[model samples]
Target: MQQQRLPLALFLSLFGFACAGTARADAGSARLPDWRVSGFGTIGVAHAGEREADYTSSVMKANGTGATRSWSTDVDSRLGVQLDTTLARRWSAVLQVVSEQGLDNSYRPRIVWANVKYQATPELALRAGRIALPVFLIADYRKVGYAYPWLRPPVEGYNVMPVTSSDGVDATWRWSAGPVRNASQVFYGHSAVPLVDSLHLYARHGVGASNTSDWGALSVRVNVLRADITSNIGQDLFDAFDAFGPAGQALTARYAMDHKRMTLVNVGASYDPGTWFVMAEANRAISHSFLGATRSGYVSAGWRWNTLTPYVTWARVQAVGATLDPGLPTAALPPALAPMATALNAGLNSLLMRIPQQTSFAAGLRWDLRTNMALKVQVDRVTPHDGSTGTFINPTPRFVSERTSHVASVALDFVY
Candidate 1:
């Protein structure tokens, strides 16, 4: 794996070096007509009513509100700066860096986008380097808090796939059909992201396509993606299973996260007139490994009263495949190994319980403080179902799976 990553690491290093050199070269010049710089940030805090588990925005975060802390800024605080430059009439480039709370519990600046684009024609464009994956309707702007009406996108649907970008190439074509305008994109790439517990998620041989259409105030999108994913999140547990001979091997083969294939399908739509807006999205994840299969969706609507927008959202995530598996009949084992067998079986079942099955209802109000700044306050009632802990992390012994948690959040978003 290290060898495979060498090329990408070298490419990124060279790209950064070139960009830095360009900046230094342009410093002596008075005006840079081809260069543009912009930035965005969010200052936020959240508190979760449940004390036994932490409520995190995504698995990439190490800790969040509730048990970890009374109020946490890691759930939403972030800063991003982007530089765009036109290299030529047909060539352009963009570099964006973001600093946010990461799985290692640090606010490290990472490259969110570093892509060069070639304008093939009036309606076609090609790009190479790290590009954002268009997995959902608002995926391209999900990190820009000021661009959206909610404090954050619904976690139930957005957190299913934590990956944000990939290293590869993509092509986009835009055309107008009658009264509707359409944009279609096709991409191929691979991604690797670090997670908590020293685990890493890798998606190889990823391919995807998406299309979006806009007509008046209405917009709709559909996307399909597939990849071979691997993770070592539960290495210790799987290693123990490997010790139990063929039965244990079979169990590991069925549940281990070893180069498993996963497919994702997403459909979304939105309508925004001047005074009001409504948006909804649905996602389906198919996998045969321990990740299982899931159906998730969310619906949101808001009324714009002057500069204040009040919005309500309902979201749900359910496991559609088997959440638990009967592994190795402990009773059939030898008397001396019965205890160990039973323990292993219990452990396997416990791991399976991590699958998310939850429902959330949220209401928020966004106050547009200025044309470039906004303040938001939101409250969510989250309930775990079917003994799943939902998206909460760091569960303690006192954690109850079916318990409901109420979270309150406030955020200030700005762009400049």
Candidate 2:
């Protein structure tokens, strides 16, 4: 497995103490400490109908099904463990570790949350260290399958940007007025995320805020964030560009990925009253880099009848091209440099074209097997726009333009 050895021991120590509490409970039920340990996981199988490309939940993953394709366990299966306990009268900590398919296509455990929290009063609190980014409605608990009504979150919306956590400090304030309860959170942090095999992204000087309000069965949220972004483009491509002299320099300057600013905004609302529920959310991620701009959203509704619940979802991600020019003039360049200019323009267009433009419709049924477990089956029809591949990776020449792919998945989700 591709393990991040650093900080593994620190996370293990926190989990280790939680395990000791369990051991004490086994030895003497009354002697157990306040430490609590819990976990959630999904055993899933997925298949795709298209053979020219592989379908995946995230762009970071390298594995999926295609021509050599069949059912695979790597698509949605995952396991996570969390430890929560009090350190002092007003101080507490949380540690969470997860093992799932990642950028390296391995199940190695990674620390998801390792933070200390201090409660100053009933209405205010502070936290520091690695913490979840409140970038979406379910940002903090997106991995916990039992917490949501669907088999999985709409990939088009959730996969827009894969970095989920930041390393720094955050604070929350709570208040209530009449029948409405509200909480506001503000945070500042930095992060590094490995995307695919060649793109390693870094976010610096990041700051964000999230506000949520609840009234009866209705809940609403708004979030905004900004950060300075940088990424390591493929080394081979970098060298090729570097060799092209001023032309390459101009191309790199137009992209301006290093230290460029990125902004994200989100709005979401949901209403649930026991028997039925409806939800909708929208997000915009804009940047000056090659990552470009993405606008995504999803709407879902479900009706619960006894132990069975059926749901439907519609989601899509639309790519917005950048406004900057590549400095490749068609008529002004010399004869010797015409070929280079053409190549640069073509490369720029290819990068812009790769941004996803996909729409998907999904239907699923969830069966409550027990208090903490559920069985689910889902089917999705995904259609790409303008010859884009949507969420599919490793595209081949056989991939048909504007073709729709059908994907089916079955999963058992449980928590304890």
Highest TM-score model number: 1
User: Alpha carbon lDDT of residue 408, candidate 1?
Assistant: 100
RMSD of every candidate to native, in Å, equals 3.6, 4.5
**What's the true lDDT of residue 228 in model 1?**
92
Runs in model 2 lying further than 4 Å from the true structure: 1-33, 195-199, 235-239, 242-247, 323-344
- Weakest lDDT window of 10 consecutive positions for candidate 2: 1-10
* Shift of residue 140 alpha carbon in model 1, Å: 1.0
What global local distance difference test value does model 1 have? 0.88
Query: What is the C-alpha local distance difference test score of each model?
Result: 0.88, 0.80
| lDDT of candidate 2 over 167-275, digit per residue (tens) | 7789999999899999999999988775665667889999999999999999999999999988876344445565667867666765747788999999999999989
- Location of the lowest summed lDDT over 10 successive residues in candidate 1: 1-10
Candidate 2 C-alpha error for residue 151, in Å: 1.3
Best by lDDT: 1
Residue-level lDDT of model 1, residues 216-262, one tens digit each, is: 99999999999998999777888888998999998889888899999
